[model samples]
Target chain A: MGDIQAIAKQFTDFYYSTFDSNRSALQAVYRPTSMLTWEGSPILGATDITEKLVSLPFEKVQHKVTTFDAQPSSPTIASILVSVTGLLLVDDSPNPLQFSQIFHLIPDAGSYYVYNDVFRLNYG
Target chain B: MGDIQAIAKQFTDFYYSTFDSNRSALQAVYRPTSMLTWEGSPILGATDITEKLVSLPFEKVQHKVTTFDAQPSSPTIASILVSVTGLLLVDDSPNPLQFSQIFHLIPDAGSYYVYNDVFRLNYG
Candidate 1:
């Protein structure tokens, strides 16, 4: 089995860094067969999902990971669950959003690709 | 706003009861448009997802929820994030699995239905 904890931390760092700086680079992390659930809506394929990410209505965002857990799904795949608390500056107003996201990372060409992703914001 | 904590507890009770007894009874909690991501694979539509649940390899399983958090997504919809540790009797062997699941619940009539559901087991 793979060292899931190490992968989780690495993924968190790489993912959020790309998200904050150059979301377009995320294209390399997802494939054509990938799936994303943003909040409750399902967006299929890598192109559509990346577009959605870049178009998020936030001027600036920062994510703080609270919990990072992982499990190996297959010999070459790992599943990770992450809980995050973040601040988003939208329309010059800063708001906090607590969310949990899941990622199914599949190994290919010595790197990992996001095969499945689900993100939901917690609001009361 | 609705009492999210109360609803989370109530949902836990109702969901596991039906899961332990009559898995078919889950029809009332999902609609034809419902979508489910089991582990990593996405199963669309309620009928297909229900079949997948009933056909799980375990003869008997139990879920013990450790954390239950809920946030209202819209006036009539709520988003819940739950972390569960559970045991499953598969192939006459008992094994424990830690998992995190997210549910997007939409209210219809007087009750709520799962609009989108994602479940992934944490393994290392």
Candidate 2:
């Protein structure tokens, strides 16, 4: 249970910290098989998603996690609910957005890794 | 795409309506194979979830869906984002709660059915 919480925290932390700039930290959390489907159309795997993020002009973004729900179905499988409010620096303008992220976590090589993540973007 | 939106709306409507008192309506949306995970420990299937819901004393509830995002991944598969605010009458006390529900839709026979649904309850 504790381990799952830690893993869940790690995921949100990585999302807030690395989603905008830190490439290495982002790489650390996502498995090679990881895939993201955004707005229901674009289906991109780990490498593509990372490339897309890196190519963007987002200089800084801060995520405030309002609620974090973690459930460990098994010792190796965990689910997380991460609700966030983000302050994005878009063209030097502050764009505030609310988002909810769901993560499916799995243990790999004795360490927990994010298997898949689905997110919904909300406008403020 | 339109079909998925309609199905997603049906889901929210059913949840807001039957989750309180209408047992038959509750049975309509959920399949026998459906299962729900609340908090972390409990794993109850459709029948058990319905029974538990029926035992509650909730008289009336109204759900306002703020944002409904639906994406048809394929002709037979779809995804939805349903963010809702509910007014619940609990012992004659008004309880307002914000919740976000995600639904994965699949076509069964000739109609669409929810494969899995995950929700997060937010207290205001």
Candidate 3:
């Protein structure tokens, strides 16, 4: 549990930092078989999902994680759920959007990667 | 979209109110087919999940939703994802526990119900 906690914290820090600055760097965190759900629409493959991330309308974004929790799904898998309230500066919308995100991380080669991810904005 | 948003808000209001006061009232929101994942463990069926909820260590709880997002999964199904940061006053702890919860709501008759729910505390 201690190891899991440390890894979850480190991965979350790295993940969101890259998301805000260098989204392309996230390639190392996802593989070809990774699955992503944006809002409720499903997008498959790491390449496609990263492309969508880069194409998002927000030019400047900052994620403030309010709550972070991790649980071991199996001997080798850990699912980390994070609740975040973030600021997203978009074109049409001047107000920063708040959202929540969850990621299921899997271990490989002494590191962790995202296997399943779901993200949604906190609005109607 | 408008209808879905209204129902999601109403359901959330009612659900948490019952959760804080009369947990037994939540029985009407979940069916036998309902599924719940608490922390990392899975509990099947409505009766079992309600039992677990009622038996939780916390004596008083309150959920303050920071973000509420809903998406239509199908013509007849809607998935609502909520990000919450709330306080839980337990017996052994002086400070309230903060947590986040996500609920996947499905439509039945003219109302919505929790089909799949996942909850976890925001701590290591």
Candidate 4:
């Protein structure tokens, strides 16, 4: 069994750090079948997701995770579900916006790839 | 291929309606392996989940879905991912709170069970 807490912490740290510094490189964690629902808009495939992330209008952004939980899913499958609630700072904005993100990870070789991702800003 | 949009809409409607009307009945959709992260607290199994939900302090609550998206995941394994952003009213509070939820559903005996669920209130 995978240590879900440790995995959640490590993955969230790496994911946000990469997202803050180099959004394009974040594509390394996603596979060709990966799908992302960005604020209710669907973006499929690794290439499209990467493009969508890279094309975000904000020049600078930071994610501060307030809470997160992860669970090992499907007894026969090596998969994990992670849910994160955080505050996002865009363009050095003083007021951070609340955000929610869910990521489904599946083992590939010795590592993992994101199979599904969903992101939304809480306060419109 | 499953109709993700239609499924999400139907599921959300049923879920919230059941949640508001009869919290205990919601257990019919969850199994022993199911896990829920409620406001950062972990609750496992249908029985425990129902107990926790029923024990909530609020007597009345309403959910207004602002936006939702869903996707079919893992070609080999049939599963669906649904993410929702909504406003929640608790105890007839005039101020509605922002909320986020993600549910992973798996097929069993022609219907689906909640395998993993995550919920959080956006504001502190």
Better of 1 and 2 by lDDT: 1
TM-score per candidate, chains pooled: 0.51, 0.59, 0.55, 0.95
lDDT of 2 by residue, B2-118 (tens): 765677678677766665546545655557655444433234456776675566545565556655555443322343433333333454555555566555454567665544455
Q: Write the per-residue lDDT of candidate 4 for residues B1-124, one digit (tens) a residue.
A: 3476777678889999999889999999899989998987889999999999999999998889987878886687667888888998899688998888988888888888899888988875
lDDT of 1 by residue, B18-94 (tens): 78777777777778777676765767677898898988876666666644545443322244433323333334455
Interface DockQ per candidate: 0.05, 0.16, 0.08, 0.70
Candidate 2: regions farther than 4 A off: A20-24, A73-95, B1-17, B20-59, B62-98, B103-118, B121-124
Fnat per candidate: 0.00, 0.00, 0.00, 0.71
How do the residues A12-120 of candidate 3 rate in per-residue lDDT, one tens digit apiece? 8998889878887888888876767786667777899889889887677766675565544332234443333344445456576655577657667867777667686
Question: Evaluated with TM-score, which candidate comes out highest?
Answer: 4
Q: What level of docking quality does candidate 4 show?
A: medium
Better candidate number, 3 or 4, judged by lDDT: 4
DockQ-sorted candidate list, best first:
4, 2, 3, 1
Residue-level lDDT for B15 in candidate 2 = 69
Tens-digit lDDT string for candidate 1 (A30-111): 8887777676566877899999999887767766665554544332234443433333333445555555576656667767
Best by lDDT: 4
Each prediction's total of clashing residue pairs, residues at least 3 apart in sequence or on different chains, is: 3, 0, 0, 0
How does each model score on lDDT?
0.63, 0.54, 0.66, 0.87
Return the top candidate by DockQ.
4
How big a share of the true inter-chain contacts is recovered in candidate 4? 0.71
